[model samples]
Target: MRLSDISIKNPVFAWMLMFGLMIFGLISFSRMGVSQMPDVDFPTVTVSVSLDGAAPEVMETQVVDPIESSLMTVEGIESIKSSSKTGSASITVEFDLDRNIDLAVQDVQAKISGIQRMLPDDVDPPSISKTNPDDQPILWLALTYDKEDPEFLMRYARDYLKDRFTTVEGVGDIFLGGYTDPVMRVHVRPKDLLRYNISVNDVVDAIRNEHSELPGGYIQTDKKTFNVRTMGEAKTEEEFRNIVISRRAGVTVADPTNMVKIRQVADASMGLDKIERMSRFNGKTALGLGIRKQRGTNAVSVARAVKEQITVIQKTLPPGMNLQVNFDSTKFIEQSVGELNHHLILAVIFTSLVCWMFLGSWSATFNVLLSIPTSLLGAFIGLYFLGYTLNTFTLLGLTLAIGIVVDDAIMVLENIFRYNENGRGRIESAILGAREISFAAMAATAAVIAIFLPVAFMKGIIGKFFMQFGVTISIAVFLSLVESLTITPMRCAGFVHHGERKTKLGKGFEALMENTRIGYDRWLRVSLQHPWKVLIGSLVFVAVSFISIKFLNKEMSPAQDQSIFMARLIMPVGTSLQYTDQQTKKRKRGSCPVRKSNRCMQPWGALVAVFLIPT
Candidate 1:
């Protein structure tokens, strides 16, 4: 059967089909994930190894060189870069964009395992990880306190709050910054060690041996056997200090009739780990918790979840402590998405009003306007199935598609109205009008598709960003074409005016259009009479536009108002972590109002690798 014949004769079936599409579209849209940007897999992997007390040069030769050599043989490797720092080495391998990341990671793991025997015995096992851009921190939280020391706060967060944040849905990792645990630092002077006839190595061995748990052989009895467990770990700093190093029986003039202990040879005291890193907020000694979301998860949702959990976490915090969120990545996403939605609604309303004013009948306007929602709703289904997220680019495409989608519907409806006014029956005019414009409408839609479909085939990050946009617009246009041929004619056959039914509003609009037509006719006649003058005027206009192009400023993308700001501190090489923290504190204090009485953090030896200062 003919397309229009089927739609007009069986209007109920057509309506039912449309209703099904609407239902599916709504369901798909509701179920789709929301994020700040589309999910992109960065093609990079990292291998890091740590060897204590090794110089940078030693790290390069023993750790980085071995790993880089092995990774070079992996398939699809694009490039390799390595960095050797004090006692540590990091090697990053970049692979082809189209390569399977899991397979690449597996290949790296295999390569590392083969070179295990070649690596230094004291070096820790090499770690292989795939780096994702999306894994960057989505939220920065600060836990500031006045009365408590920073070391206490750091331990509190590590012991109590770290696991709490981890339990939140979509939270991948939580990094604690600018805080370190109080580790015992034993200062053994050379005179004390010599007097006791003990070496620093002997003291180290004693401390290491003092803290351990080992399983002993099972004790067998007549009835049952019990497993033997020995716990020798120190529970307090005094207990650790009292650990014995060596016993002397007054056999020599330098040795006394006493056991040389850790407390005698080395003064054991609680102190922070040697500060390697420090974070500060607004000039206050601060501890930061950076929250990252898991891959493929919604960043906005995950960030929201973290914020809500923070509220709960605060209730349990110490009285003087406060947790404040300084940076949230989703604020821009929410604002941009909301603004786009507002513009989308406004466009639909204005476009519908334009259709009504031009058609001079509410029913004819409805016939054309129905295509907008139908096309957009159907496009959501396509987006969901194609794994496209609702991002700024995709929404922009939908907004631009609004004009294109309505064109075919208007064309079909106008043709049907023209035939109906020319003494044709409503049903016959609807079917015949739609049939007459079917090929034209198809060709026009194809032309629009042609303009954007090529973008989908382009390569690299730019291409990936626009691929969803092009596909989104193309799908909406195609759906609109189908809607115009089917639903537009079916509705027009029933609701469109079949005779010259005129109202005051209709008569006024008709008179206005008639005047416009006359004015255009006169202008056309004048142009035809003075073709040379018209040609010169057109040439002048073209020249002006061409000249204006050079003055326009261009940018790849507009800057977004993210409601967050960052401060970066570039310190000199070999600077102590303590010095970095001190500098950071001074800068932080100047940026925000801080309570002087509050020692936001205690001086601890904990070292931070990279710190984030949020304002």
Candidate 2:
């Protein structure tokens, strides 16, 4: 039997099929991952090596060159880019889109391992890591304290906060921003070192040699053998300070314990490792905790879980310390998706109203409107099966689909209503009406799909982004065509009333339609009679359109509101922490930096602009 016949006779099957699609679509939506963009495999790996006190030239020649040369032989390598900064070398290896990033990283690690012995003894082993778009921080949290020292904040975050955040689901890693591991600082006065006749190397040797512990070998006995442990590990600043440096031999009647200690020659204290990086929020000393989500996870769900956990964690924080969310990625995605959904709903309502006004029948409008949800709901099934996420691109496709999906249903129902108005029976009119436009509907759907199919299969990054959009629109359109052929006719046969009941709105609509038809016919006759004048006017309109194209500014993509802002302060050369703090506090909008000598005179200006800081 024909599809429409089956749909009308076995309407139960059609209803059940539509219901099944709705159920599966809802389930798929709930299970689908939410992200800012499609999870495209970046296929990039970075190898970084640090050699302290080495110049950029030395790093390039010694560290970066060898790694790049070795990695050039790896499979699927597209390009290799390297940069040599002061005392460090960074090499990024990009692979073809089809390359497995995990295997590529393994190959890099193996290459590094083979070349480790060739590198300098002081240079650290290369750090190999696979980079993904998911590596972008999902959240930026700033932890600030009013009266606590940096050491205290660092210790607290390292000991308590870092581990807790790592345990949160979907969190791949928690990087403590502006954090420094502790180190013992030895401040040696030049005068003191000269007086003691000791050099920096001598002091280093004293600490390194005396502060270590080694196994003292087992002492054997007849009854039992005991393990002997040496106990020279320095556990305190005072202990480190007391380490012996040198002893002077003098021929005199004096006490034998006359060796010079490290503290006597040089001051010893605990401090953070040489300050390489610092974090601040509005000029105030702050620690940022960047939480990154795992690949293929729902960013909205993960961010919500993190926020909820942070609420529970706040009660346990020490007084005067506060944790605030600086940036949340989901806020933007949720807002964009919500706005699109709102527009989608509005489009459906407006489209329904237009259908009612034009068709002048509530049943016809209802039948036309039914296709919107059925087709969109069915698109979710395709997305779920294709491993696509509910991201901005996919949502955009759905938004555009809102305008196209209803056309098929509108065509089918309008034809059916017209046939019924001609005195045909309900079932006969529904079936014949749908059958007449079946080819037209199919052709229209295929033409639209053909236009977007090329975009869906585009090559490179742009293609990856637009693929979901194209696929989503095509799926919705195709399903609407199906619904138009089957469900639309079946519904029309059952629900469409035999005769139109007269109403004031209906009369007004008929009057408007009559006026529109008259104006169109008059315009067509005028155009046919004065063909030369119509051609001239058309040429002028076309010329203006082409001329307008030059004035229109274009960009690759429009900027989306991410619901976050950032500001950067550039300090002058040799600017002291105190001077920087004093200048920063001069601005009414900025907070104070963590420093004691905060009183100084310097004018500073911060241009309010967005800057994407390199990670």
Candidate 3:
């Protein structure tokens, strides 16, 4: 027996099955991650190495060259690019799309390890990480303090707020921008060094030797053992200045007159660490807290959790300190998803209205509309199991599927209604009509699946991006086919009535459809009489469409208004940070007259400044 025949015989079974699917789909949807785009792991890895005081030329030859050469032997590498900059080197390797990112990372790491010993000894260990676009920060916050001490914000962020934010669920990492630690700096006078005939290394060795705590041997007694330690680290600027560097040969231990001390040659004081980068919010110096979410997590959920945590943190903050949001990336995602949802609902409503106008029966329209939700909701189950997110691509697929999913239902309903109009009972007509149209419905569904299924398995980066889109539409269509054969037939047999009362609007729609049918028949007869002319016209239309393709605008995605604008400023090579900051300020002043608007200007040591203007 056909599935539809079984569902009609046992109507209870069909209802239970529909309810079960709806329940499971809802549960799966609640657990699925939400983001702006599909989660695609790019087959790329980056290796970064650092060496203190190393020039770009030295880093290129010693670090980047050796690393790139070693990585060349790794399998599936599409391309390799390297950048050598002051004190650092970076290498990026992109693998074939079919390559697994995890396996590729391991292969790259093995190659780097093999060449580690051959590289310069002073080069720091290379850090390796996979490339993922979703790994970027989802939210940014600016911290400001009214206190005069510049180091207070950095210290607070490092010691307290960072740890607190790290504990939040879904938070992967917390990065502090424009952060500098406190350190004791020693400035040596070149004249004093020449007079004493002492090299710069001598003073460095003296401080390294004295500014440390050393382990002392234990003194064991008869019944107890005591551990001891020597505390020799300098606790103040004066103590660091007093550290002895050298002494004359004839100097006595009790007399310090012949001793050469740090105070005599250098000035020591506590100050901020070397400033390589700076961050400002609304033209005020501030520390930025950038929060990154873990892989495969929901961006919206993570942002919500962080905001709730911020609310709690506000109560515990000290006086004269303020925390404000600088930028949020999830706001756009939420709004876009919300808009797509609205579109999806409208599509369903319009599709049902069209079906009602043609069918001219409320019961038939109701049965057809049932299939739309049943198919869409059931698709969520498949998406969840496939590890897909409800992102733009998948949601767009669902929206487009709204039109296609109703095809099977409309075919079955129209056939069953025709049988009933021929004087057969509803139950007998439904069974025979559904059975007759079953093979045709399956064939139509198969045609659509054939077109989209290949897209899901396409080989390339583009395939990866659209895989979810194709699979989502295929799942919705397949589910609709099942519903048409099962629930749709069962409902038509039991609930759908023949010769139901029609309103005036429904009568008018029926008249309009009859006129359209008459017009179509007249055109069909005319075309049959002039087959040669019809063929030529159709050929001309196809040729025109093909020629017009060149005039169409093609792009990966359409431009969107994100409510923010950014400008990048690049200075000449070797420009100092101070000069870059000055230039950025000049550009900021010249570009916009509204000083009260929120602005974020970040300048790094490479003489690059990024200015963000939020609308």
Candidate 4:
């Protein structure tokens, strides 16, 4: 017996199965992550090494060359690119699409380890990390202080704010920008160094030796042993100044010696570390707290949690300090998903109206509409199990499937309705009608699945991006076939009746469709009579379509009005951070007229600037 026959005979079985699927799908939908785009892991890794004050030429030869040579030995490598800059070198290795990124990273690490001993001794250890979209910050906060204490805001963020934000669920890491730790600065006089006949390295060694606490050997007495530690670290600027660099004898052979201390050759004070970059909000110096979310987590959910945590954190902030959100990356994701949802609902509504118009019976139209939600919701089960997010591509697939998913149900419903019109009982017509068309419905669904299934398994980066789209449509189509053979048939048998009443609008729509059918038939007969002319015309139209392609604008994606845009300023390579800040300030002032205009404004109207200094 066919599945439709079983469903018709045992109505309770069909109803329970339908309800069970819907329940499971709803649960899966609730648990699935939401994002702007599908999560794809690129087969790329980066290795960064830094050596303080190393010249670009030195870094390229000593650091970048060795690392690239090592990474070349890793399997499945597509390309290796290196950038050597003052004091730092970065190497990016891209692997083939078939390569597993985790294994590739391990191989790369092993290769680098093999060459580590050959690299320069002073170079820092190589930092290795895989490329991930989630590494980008999802939220940015601007912290400002009313007082002139530059160190206070950074200390508060490091000691308190960072810990608090990290406690929020799904937060991966917190990064601070435009802030530096306080350190003792030693400004050595070049003339004094020459007079003392001491090199800068001598003073550096003296400070490095004196400003560290070292472990001493344990002191053992008769009855007990004690762990001894040397207290050599300086706690105050004066202590650092008192450090002795060298001692020299006087002019006379037997004269007493002269001691040269750090105070004589250098001035020491507490100040910020090197300022390489800065962030500003509304033209005021501010510290930026960028929050990155963990992988495989919902961006919207994480942002919501961070906002809620921010409310709790506000109470603990100091009186003269303030924190405000400067930029939120999740807002675009939320808005895009919301818009897709709106379009999905409209597609369903319009599709239902079209079905009602053609079927001319509200009861039959209702059976067809029931297939849409069941098929779409059931697709969530596949997506959840496949680790797919509710992103643009998946949601777009569902939206497009709104029209396709109704095909199977419409075929079965129309056939069953024809049987009922032939003086047969509803239940008997449904069973006979569905069994007759079940093979044809399955064939049609198979054709669609065959077309899309290959798309899901396509190779390369483009395939990864569109795999969700293909699989989503295929799942929805498959589920629709299942519903048509089971729930759809069952519902039709119970609800649809022969010669059911129709409204005037439905009657008018049916009349219009009948006229259209007659017109189409007349044209079809004419075309059959002049097959040669019709074929030539079709060829001409196809040719025109191909010719028009060159005139069309092409892009990866259409431009959208996201209510935000960014402008970048690149200065000369030798420009300083202070100069970059000044130039950005001038540009910000020049845009005041646009900011004041009511036509072009955003909710966060202030212009946020980031200053960068070349290495």
Clashes of each: 14, 0, 0, 0
Give the per-residue Cα lDDT of candidate 2 at 504.
89
What TM-score would every model get versus the actual structure? 0.84, 0.82, 0.91, 0.90
Clashing pairs in 3: none
What are the RMSD figures for all models against the true structure?
Answer: 5.0, 5.9, 3.2, 4.4
In candidate 1, which residue ranges exceed 4 Å CA deviation?
Answer: 179-182, 215-225, 246-259, 498-556, 581-590, 593-615
The residue ranges of model 4 lying beyond 4 angstroms of the native Cα positions read: 190-198, 215-230, 236-239, 242-264, 500-502, 543-547, 596-615
Clash count, predicted structure 1: 14
lDDT of 3 by residue, 348-414 (tens): 8999889877777778888889888889989999999998988999999999999999999999988
The 0-to-1 C-alpha lDDT of every candidate, in the order given, reads 0.80, 0.80, 0.87, 0.83
Best by TM-score: 3
Q: Pairs clashing in candidate 2?
A: none
Model 2 ranges off by over 4 Å: 41-46, 71-81, 92-111, 128-133, 188-199, 202-268, 525-551, 560-565, 572-615
Please give the distance, in angstroms, between residue 337's alpha carbon in candidate 2 and its true position after superposition.
2.0
In candidate 1, how many Å is residue 23 off?
2.9
- Give the C-alpha miss distance for residue 606 in model 1, angstroms: 13
